[model samples]
Target: MTTSSRLADTPLAGELIRGALEIESTGRGLLPHRLPAWARAQCADGQLHMAESQPSGVRLVFRTRATVVELDTIPTKRVYAGAPPRPDGVYELLVDGRPAGRGSVPGGDTLHLDAATGTAARRPGPAGTLRFGGLPDRMKDVEVWLPHDETTELVALRADAHVEPAPEPDRPVWLHHGSSISHGSNATVPTGIWPARAARLGGVELVNLGFGGGALLDPFTARTIRDTAADLISVKIGVNLVNADLMRSRAFGPAVHGFLDTIRDGHPTTPLLVVSPLYCPIHEDTPGPAAFDLEALAAGEVRFTATGKPDERASGKLTLNVIREELARLVARRAADDPNLHHLDGRRLYGEDDFAELPLPDGLHLDAAAHRRVGERFAALALTGAGPLAARGRRRV
Candidate 1:
């Protein structure tokens, strides 16, 4: 069949393959579905909702095609106070509404899955790809499930298909990096990650370089961004650097400058946004080595407390305020020569308002509601030309 004819025939062609299912927790109340696509045509309304009232926790199911495909789950690496302790269990992957694979995420580890084996397994970071080699060529749906777990938070779900290729020329590619929050922490699905959600919302393709706990101004990552092919780009930094105490003020400024320099070496004129950290109370003004509260973890609980006092400078921590100030200064200096460069305070996406309403359970990563808020703000800022940054080729540099 002609490509155009095939496109006419497959109504769901180029549509996202996976979506979220509402899972309930007695302790957490009704959990929201993650990454609901902005394209109404691509979404199935009320598809995933609270189904039962079991005390053990809520049992939720996703709706999707039946073709058997590989499934993988990414886990949270950084644990802090009030953070949900990683849960261990036999998580399930259901394809076309049937159990196609089963896997186990050992307690205190991230889980990965594939069709060859259904159960969840520990993965290195909040990123993994699932390959589904032998499936009906004209598949229609897909779904994934996480069994009851007190600690596990579904980050993302990705599926590979053998359908006709996407029209690459029609879409711009977005390259992004950030902390665990950007790496899909607390997000329910792979595409639910804020970057992914924003990309889908903006009708762009995405090359997600978000590495959980790996956004520390690494030269290699900067180089990777410099070399990658992207029509548009952005980097979400600061929070991770501050939270991890990876660098102090002296090194932070240089590192930020260098990272931007590397990216500019390739796409000198691409609209590049430098996003600072989102809202986190404990780290808002304190410095870090944001250590996990072992006491809470050992007790199978999550908590976040002030690690450094306001008057204490001996600890040499970088707070959100510090990062934000530095980032603004850096961008101001760079924008003088690089008009394409822009800076955005992460709170513009998830700010004190959100923190007040849907406070992060761990005081670090955003919860599902906060994720939606961030996604919406990002779409408005990055896509709609609503923020200070302009869209497409409007940059002078």
Candidate 2:
């Protein structure tokens, strides 16, 4: 299964991949972005640009007979001030569409984030190499799943034998958009994220648009989803809006309607599920903009606390309780008219009782175990029954 070409000669670039909308070659690697160049041009803020470029659900697929496969890349790792270092991003190898092996490449530039100042600084680091060896001699389909949370740049890829793009899988494509919780905020690895887990369980290809701290129910995001090909779609709403204190109740209903309206423009019959926020103790009854607990940070702990007063709800400020109520009401009304539309209480996936058993560690995001639990619960709730995503059919909508 050996090839005659040298490592330098066989370096596969982004053109061999199918998922990325934009791929830009850098001095060290090739950066792949989820949003297209046209959509990216519409964005002016650096934060939004960075969030959309984090290659969530983007995978490099190929077929190879090589025993050894290698990848060279630079991953943009996050470094939060005063908090413990998070795990390195994972690159999962799927042989014939099933997980075969996983590896993490070390050495990458770090994005230093300061909670107090709400600013980020980049520090340069060396590129890391990922190698997967000891594969079967026969040719097989392979897919390299990029980090769900990190911004990855593909510098090069090499195989002992020839490698070509893997054949497409005839499976439903599930497009999902959400906030940081869906973005693998505290999850240990990329594949460990709930949506990734749910995608596998549901046996569907994934197109994740979960942006960390960036899901503000943006019109651009809705338009992007509308343009993307999806048989199933779900939008996890409310957490970012509530935690960021971005909108009041009055704006929430109309905004949700507009977002769904935009997505329906393209996917009129695609089953769409609307999910509310999970159980976050800090934002359940209290309103946000959630602030970091500086005292806990000084003690080398990352904790979130609501800054807005509980009485703010009467003034239209959002809380988890308020958001859940509004979202349920909105979805119910929409479902009454549109059969493809459905609603799921995020609490049903991770409710109060579950919280008492496996509570959210940082008062915001769920831990790895919680992620697994939520993912399994969601698979059962959304992928079964006479629900919207159960079977494809034209209904009276």
In candidate 1, position 13 carries an lDDT of: 17
Off by over 4 Å in 1: 1-169, 313-316, 387-397
Best model per lDDT: 2
10 residues in a row with least lDDT, candidate 2: 1-10
Writing each residue's lDDT as its tens digit, candidate 1 over 1-397 gives: 0111112122221123222222323231223222212322232322111111100111223333324343333323323233453433344454443545555443234434332233334444333323333444454434333332223433333333343322223556666666667756676544445765686577665555555566778676677677767767889987777656667677888888898999999888888999988888888877765755657656775555656666544445578888888899989998999887888888889888888899987767777677777877898887666643334543222
lDDT of 2 at 104: 87
| TM-score of every model versus the real structure | 0.63, 0.92
For candidate 2, give the lDDT: 0.82
What lDDT does model 1 reach?
A: 0.56
User: Alpha-carbon error at 164 in model 2, in Å?
Assistant: 1.2
Residues 71-101 of candidate 2: C-alpha lDDT, one tens digit per residue = 8878889888778787788889888767788
Per-residue error at 368 for model 1, in Å? 1.4
Local distance difference test scores for all models = 0.56, 0.82
